[model samples]
Target: MSGDRKEVVKLLAEFSTIGMSVAFSIFIGVGIGYFLDHKVFAGRTSPWLTLIFLGFGVAAAFKNLYLMSRRKDL
Candidate 1:
């Protein structure tokens, strides 16, 4: 019983972190894109790089969701 309870609690903790992980992934992606566009390119790329990076971030978030859903333990 103790082992089972421990497993449940561990799984609960992992699940709880999913939202934060997803958000962080997106934020990091956007931050990189923003840095490249504004600092590296000096506003020449402007919104394009930002938009491209935002899409990448969104794709990464969805990928994280898919992987989590496919977890065998879940």
Candidate 2:
């Protein structure tokens, strides 16, 4: 029914919003951490490495979410 289709669309929109927010939060957190690490700890041990890893992790999460969104079954 049209109503069911509308509902599905609405749910998917909400899900996508949540997924994007999570991805953006991770990206921003990693970026800020990396900036501070290299800025403040340039002469000492670098925590930027961890930020790099976290950035990749966030990117991977976004990729997976994108793939899932493409699936017909959701």
Candidate 3:
């Protein structure tokens, strides 16, 4: 295979790994937050917990997009 093609493949693999790690971390964080909200909140306001998850989710998405944008040449 050509050198450029090899580099592209390598970049893609790295990007996918990073993206998947972020996604998984987000999933785990949200899951734990939900459980805590359910178990600890009981009757109290939950907007803070919701907002926390929202912020993390958005941050994860933006990070993934940023990483993807960095490899435009690939």
Provide the TM-score for each candidate, comma-separated: 0.90, 0.41, 0.54
Could you tell me the lDDT of residue 42 within candidate 1? Answer: 99
Q: What is the lDDT for 65 in model 1?
A: 92
Clash counts per candidate, in order, are 0, 0, 0
Candidates 1 and 3 compared: the better one by lDDT is: 1
- The models' CA-based lDDT, in order, is 0.91, 0.70, 0.72
RMSD per model, one decimal: 1.3, 4.7, 3.5
Worst 10 residues of 1 by lDDT: 65-74
Off by over 4 Å in 2: 1-3, 41-45, 48-74
Least accurate 10 contiguous residues by lDDT in model 2: 43-52
In candidate 1, which residue ranges exceed 4 Å CA deviation? none
Total residue pair clashes for candidate 3: 0
Q: After superposition, how far is residue 68 of candidate 1 from its true place, in Å?
A: 0.5
Candidate 2 yields a Cα-based lDDT of 0.70
Name the best candidate (by lDDT): 1
Preferred candidate (TM-score higher): 1 or 2: 1
Q: Name the better of 2 and 3 by TM-score.
A: 3
Please write out the lDDT profile of model 1 over residues 1-74, one tens digit for every residue.
69989999989998898899899989988998999999999999998998899889989998989999999876
Summarize candidate 3's per-residue lDDT along 1-74 as a digit string, tens digits: 99989988888787777767777767866765676577788626465675687568668767777877786575
